[model samples]
Target: MSALAYSQLPNHLQPLLAKFYRAHNSRNRIRSEAICWVARRGDIVGGLCLTPVAQGHFLTGLLVTPPERNRGIGAQLVRNAVASSAGPVWLFCKPELVEFYSRLGFSVANCLPATLADRLTRYRSSKTLIALQNDQRMMPMPNATLNIAIACLLDDCGRILVVRKRGTRFFMLPGGKAELGETPLQTLRRELREELDLQLEDDDLDPLGHFQAQAANEPDHQVEADVFIARLPRAVTVQAELEEMAWLEAAPCERDDIAPLLRGHVMPALLARMAQAERVACCAATSDQGEIGSLAGKVSSIASSS
Candidate 1:
């Protein structure tokens, strides 16, 4: 796409494209040649850039605004890049980002002998590494089983143990569906073990509550979250399998930080329960006042102690 057509997008989107340009556009050479635009409502939400060094060789860069991510935009952008380019493309990413790039038909060719040039370039500027020789490897997505998962809430020292949601940016309780060889408790424990490397005892779990929470950022998927209260034997470090994990104060409904389901529905329900508790306390106080007046006359003569 040329400048005029690319400029048609909204101002916010234009900056995203500009950022890609600034990264790919540098002092030495013209590294990027192609750009793919992902738009909605006539506004550019995402874009991908490609720089070809030779025949059947190219490097790629993808940029997407936070709000428009996880809708397969990255994959779509990569598909466009592959189709437009001639042959074996390459991309460089951190070990953690391997999965993300893998989903877009990329594989690790070499992890050893960390390139000295690449390292120095990365140290000087991140874009230098991102612009390294085009990766020729392609990784196809393997068939993966789809299943429902749930999180059981357990509080420890004011910190909450949460299972990072797979394939999304959120954390909740740690639980999932039972596989063929697993029982309910086994499945729950297994998920925790796999996701957080933790073992659980039967006595440690107490049923706190259960509710239906729609999958965050997903429309059709719904989860029957069976929340529980428990204490961890000791603090355990979270493995990288889940996106991330953290404990948040159980408070007002909000999606700014936590999962959408928790922010949109679960927190609201909990807030209502807290309000109910306050109402119950007020009623108990009123009843105690009446009882005090009735007991006052009897107390005056019933028990006179020196």
Candidate 2:
């Protein structure tokens, strides 16, 4: 596949691009200054348009033919647009597609540029536009920080419960930011109740360790975590504040969305504790067997002597 500049595209491919944009119901007119990137696999397989908006560029009309979907053509098109653009890139997509864009390194913004915001509002009202099915907005890309408490709730099967917040792709521990006057443990308990609907007392939680890592949602910001190990019940009804939940093994996970602190610090600590507990249990069992053997020999000798 190759990325072609708009002027580089053959005249024969121009019609195909127009058809692709129409199919997606894109209203953004291709202006003289706008940058369009087309992905071709002998024919036009996918494409994206970046139009200048305020201080950044708005990514629009991104589409991959159904036959070419999941083949990485869409991702390549996005990469091309981002690589060619000199400013921050922004886009409005359905709430469901937030994770998709997030994996491509686009952070969701709590605020948006005025022009893009107006366009998004209008796009939502248009029934012809399928991509803007939800009212979720995208913001200009910037770095920010998040303060939160995290928990490593391990089940009997040695799986840790990880949670992904709404509108986010990465899955971290089931905890939130520390509220004023609330200790880390208190934050953990409150978050558990609010996020997982699981209640716990101080006795149920054990301090694993304090950790720090990059925040998943905010770029260039760090997350300071007070990590703890909580014993989860056999079954849990996760609250709706989370997008999804998973019971992942305490090992090197291949998932990209796993939080940095959980992957680097929390999991390893939990694994070490589990190993230590196993060793202690094995030693205790061996000692008990040795005691039993010694008592058996003494009883046998006493019987023989009598």
Candidate 3:
């Protein structure tokens, strides 16, 4: 369908599309063959389109009129669009519409290299990209705040200690935001002591890294989490502020289990620290061995002097 014909849809339906997709601009948007189809039921009851831009491929304006929805037209339109796109296809959807796209073989993946989250931060209060699904839209709000925590540290033993966020069913790390007059380090220590009942000195706090995550457990909130690594004490006890805790392996808390910002920025830094630690150990061991050999030579020299 030509972009002109799609643009000619009834006036009322235009706002519906625009509401779900902020990118829907009737005057400015000209249709490209690169875009998928613009389906109309006699009077243009529904439409779907694909827009390819420099950042990545985005599916937009998948709309079905309120009266004609749930008759399988929307799914058919989306399926056609997905088949045409080559690279990673992404669309924004609200918390409610996650299942609808999932059933259509669209699992919620991180909007990577530049997602709605990144755009919110970059564009400064404008939603750079809005994902659409059914009646819901995952629109970006600039510099949105989120609640977050570092769940666990995957040690050499492959054990991960997942902490339950205080007073939430969703499990996360035992940490909280910085209070008045508290640095990130101070906030972490206070939170750890409050939730896990462990005392940690400054040296014990290994800066793990920070990550971007959606607070799906809460409405209209997101988080940029700063994770840290600490030596967990044996037989650690917990306090009431912590709801629950568990120790799972690395597989469950893989990058997917954490927030997106952490996956890209925070995890890389943590991995680099791990590498640095290994290098330091190797250097220390070599130095010790050299010292032992030098001591024996010194004793042999003293005997020759005698």
Candidate 4:
């Protein structure tokens, strides 16, 4: 019922992991440099390893006991490994498992990087593996670029505001491409007003950070995003300019339709901010209660004296 890092795992679990690797015929692939996540219920029930490869990180040696297979333990282990990873993550799974991984936010690539190509060949030669259909439409062309300014608007209940543009399935933070002469804030302000009919002043927006990711709408181009945080009133109505709007809880695992930048970066930052704000509010509430207690004590003393 708990997940542990490779180093934090007890000595007793190593033999179990080795057995799992042996069962998968991947015993030789274990590396000390790799990060492993082990899931345990009483004892080790499942595990997965993430090794640093030239392309990014390669996921390997995934295993779950028969009893634990359908219970989602393997999925949780993979999710934890991916969330902990800093950069791109890659994995090689059986053809049947392609849909499983795809639902976890990995696209089936027609061609892999040079580092993964050799491994793919080895895997195919060993097993009856076929190449995933090369989808040119999903592949980004070389040397493409896009610029966007995105807003991270949170409602009173702390859910984030995300908008899905017309004809696109991915729901991303509200905002759009920046104009040539506009600052990031200006771009966001204009985009919000134009896209959502929501007016924001400079004081209402807090600069979160700048990030770059594969553009959701434009294939082969990277979108450089300047992200900002704004708080929306609970009663505000969002009038969509392009398609539709929804308040999202920033939960990445529940859905795979979120934009990459938001899933990988912006959501983490927003979550951190939410935590900090909650802490501040907690401290203020405690301080206020302490002040009220002190005042109450003083009044009680005065009444007693009188």
lDDT of each: 0.54, 0.72, 0.57, 0.72
lDDT of 1 by residue, 89-147 (tens): 65556556675566455665443223433544655564423322324344344333224
TM-score of each: 0.38, 0.52, 0.42, 0.49
Residue-level lDDT for 25 in candidate 3: 42
Q: Please say which candidate is ahead in TM-score: 1 or 2.
A: 2
Stronger candidate by TM-score (2 vs 3): 2
- The runs of at least 3 residues in candidate 4 whose Cα sits more than 4 Å from the true structure, single-residue gaps closed, are 1-143, 233-241, 250-253
Q: For model 3, how does the per-residue alpha-carbon lDDT over 1-306 read when each residue is reduced to its tens digit? A: 122133333444444444434333433242443354555645565676666644446666667666555444576577666665555567765567776676565665544444555644564454433343321233233345753444345545755565555556655556777777666677877877777777777687665544555563566566656577765665465675666676654332354444344444444555666688889999999999999999999999999999
Q: For model 4, how does the per-residue alpha-carbon lDDT over 165-270 read when each residue is reduced to its tens digit?
A: 8888999888888889787778989988887778889899887766666877777676777788888743444455567777787565357888888887778877
Q: Candidate 2 overall Cα lDDT vs. reference?
A: 0.72
State each model's C-alpha RMSD to the native: 17.6, 19.4, 18.3, 14.3
Taking all chains together, the TM-score of candidate 2 against the true structure is: 0.52
- What is the lDDT, from 0 to 100, of the residue 85 in candidate 2? 66
Q: How accurate is candidate 4 locally (lDDT)?
A: 0.72
For model 3, give the 10-residue run with minimal summed lDDT: 132-141
Query: How many Å off is the CA of 115 in candidate 1?
Result: 78
